[model samples]
Target chain A: MDLTLKIWRQASSKVKGQFVNYQVQNISAEASFLEMLDILNESLVAKGEEPVAFDHDCREGICGACSLYINGRPHGPDRGITTCQMHMRNFKHGETIIIEPWRAKPFPVIKDLMVDRSSFDEIIQAGGFVSVRTGGIPDANSIPIPRRNAELAMDAAACIGCGACVAACKNASAMLFVSAKVSQFALLPQGRIEAQERVQRMVAKMDELGFGNCTNTYACEAECPKEISVSNIARMNREFLSAKLISHKEF
Target chain B: MGKSLTYSSITKKIIMSLAGLFLISFLLVHLGINLLILFDNTYESFNTAAHFMATNPLIQTFQWVLFIGFIIHIIYGIIVQLQNWSARPVRYMKKGYSELSFFSKFMIHTGVVVFIFLIIHFANFFIVAKFGHVDEVTYKSGTYENLGAVVVETFKIGWYVAFYVVALLLLGFHLEHGIQSAFQSLGINHWRYTPVIKRIGTLLSILITLGFIAIPLVIYFS
Candidate 1:
């Protein structure tokens, strides 16, 4: 199939970027979105031109490394899949596809179709962990965990740390991302010890990094590659409120 | 930027929601009191209710508290709006606005219109009752200023009635989004009750809007 591509081009973080048009033809519908891009890059290299730069690790959806905003949605028009998992068949033949990086104040553009999501890392570093003793691994079934609780923890753990929530948010809010991290621990007994401190510190870090506040738009859940529920955000809110109310110390 | 408001965005929202909820209660009381005019055509009950509301010491202090609540609500709203606008400096090239709710997208827009209406409303009624004076007429029991008459005369003008009704409808829009959003912001959100809260919020907003609209309609037509 023939495709028209408008990809964002930027040489460096300090420079301004703009969309550049390119054309690719005779591509297989079975080829993945990244594979289509690979074909485009091969042609660019053959023409002695700089190929479009994007981030992708595992071709599977697990890595959460494929970050691209295709046709206004994160990871293209498809729901519940990252860029690497999207096949070219989703686009009609002769369609013009606009591809760009995630846009948010915290996730600044690194190059073409790539934005630095280290803000997510910083937020996680702030408190997305439990203070467990470093020793031999405890038996997995040692703790009496409810099935509902374990399922919720696993559900919240599905967050890919993708910045789609921020990019999709009007205010660039990181509430969805932060909330997922908070819920992953809050639902589990192992993480209950520092739950209060973890929520407070991580939320503090998220705010300090210039991420916008959540207005409950639910865009994060809509564009999520993992289809992570916004209910995690609700849970996080409950945790934050409880933590703020019970604690005496001020951040 | 006030250090005391708390640095956490959710806390700021929670505080603003407290003010919003306070103001919502004030709306109900005000609505109930004003509703007296619709039933008592002779204006006795309405005027007496107004007199009591004016002279009662408890209600008087609450009026001031209501004013403070309004101040806090308006100021916090502005602060959050400023912060939100500044958070994203560069706009998206192809913004998928459909990704956001209509309520979320135009909160500030409806809020600004409602704020302007509030200023006009105060100038029309509150300022006149406080600083200026309305003519009084002797009733069956005692001599009482006919505040309801004042309302009727004001609504007699077609344009004023139109403006009043439109503004109240805008207030309805603001309240619809605000009431539920406030709950979500305050962390009262849960799967079991959040949808219930949203529906109640919408119903309450519509009722309040119609309640305010009914007064002007009854005044003008009857």
Candidate 2:
């Protein structure tokens, strides 16, 4: 199968970019989308053109590195899937695919389709971890966690920091991402020790990074490759309110 | 006040809800007055009621209060938007999908559009009737024919009624998210009661928005 691709080409963060068209022939329907891109790159290299630069590591979708907004939808018109996991079979032969990097303000274009997602790293670094120190290898059964709470924590922990929520958001809000991180920690007993500080620091970092306010638009959840629940956002809100209330009283 | 400022996003949304609900109340009062036009002799009574509302000192005071509320609500909304805009100066570059609802994703867009529509509405209806040239019509009493006649004439223009209905539709879309989220933001969510409250909010939003739309259509066609 052959396909026409209009992929965004940007040399650097400062350079203005636009979609440049390329045609690839003999694409296998069974080939994964990234593999097709690989084929395109090989063709480009042979033709003495710069290979399109896109981010990918664990092509299995766990890394959340491959982010592409194909056509108008993110992750190429698929539900509950990452870009690397999307297959060429989704597109027909001779189809024109419009590929662009995530259009959120926080994730600036580094080159081609790759974007600087380090803002997510900074948000996580702000307070994504529990302050509890590891002394000795503690018994897992020592801490009693409610089954429901454990499950909820695990669900919140499922967020891969893909920034899809930000991309999918019309206002480009990162509340869903920040909330998931906050809720994951807030739900656990170990996380409770630093809950107040964690939420405060992380939320402040999120605000400082310039993510939009969450208006309860679940676009983030919908576009999340991990299928993170919007309920995490609710939980985060509850936690933030409680944290602020408690901290104020003490001060 | 410091704590309130810290939670300004939630506080601002609460202010939006208060203003929105107040506007909803005003709508009910306006609807009651308009319903009187259905009766042949009650037109004068309706005019009397409207005249009193326009001229009464208390009502005038309340009207100023309403204006302030509107300004605060819209200004706060814009502030929130600008804050979000500055926060994410770039779009997301990741390619993936999740399960967010359509209404949730487009709330801001719908809200901004509705805000523009509102400005047009106020300029046409509120500004024109209050300050523009309006003829006095005498029936059972001397009432300015300005308000009702202006509304009727505006609806007579096909584009005016069309814009109004479109604006009402946007309002409906805005309420779809605003009503339920307002409760959530206020921490009113209880396991059993949240669903019930959400349903009521949806129903009220639909009815009020549709009712407002219906008025223009009825006036235009009738």
* DockQ values of all predictions: 0.57, 0.36
Could you give the interface RMSD of candidate 2 in angstroms? 4.1
Measured with C-alpha atoms, the lDDT of residue A232 in candidate 2 is 75
Tens-digit lDDT track of model 1 for B1-222? 568455588877777888998899988988998998888878898888888888899999989999988888888787777777777776667776345456777777887888998998899988887778898977877877788888888999999999989988888888888898888777676778988998999999999999999998877787
Task: Give the interface RMSD of candidate 1.
Answer: 1.7
Residue-level lDDT tens digits of model 2 in B1-222: 355345545445656667766766776777677666545433576667778888899999998888887776677677777776675564434333445444655566777887888789879877877778877777746645646666667878998888778877877777777778766665465669878977987897788787788877888788
Model 2 quality (TM-score): 0.82
Range of the 10 consecutive residues with the lowest summed lDDT in candidate 2 chain A: A242-251
Runs with alpha carbons beyond 4 Å of true place in candidate 2: A134-142, A249-251, B1-18, B44-65, B83-163, B184-198, B219-222
Q: Count clashing pairs, candidate 1.
A: 0
Distance from true position, residue B38, model 1, in Å?
2.4
Instruction: Report the C-alpha displacement of residue A230, candidate 1, in angstroms.
Output: 2.1
Query: B-chain TM-score, every candidate?
Result: 0.93, 0.84
lDDT of each: 0.86, 0.77
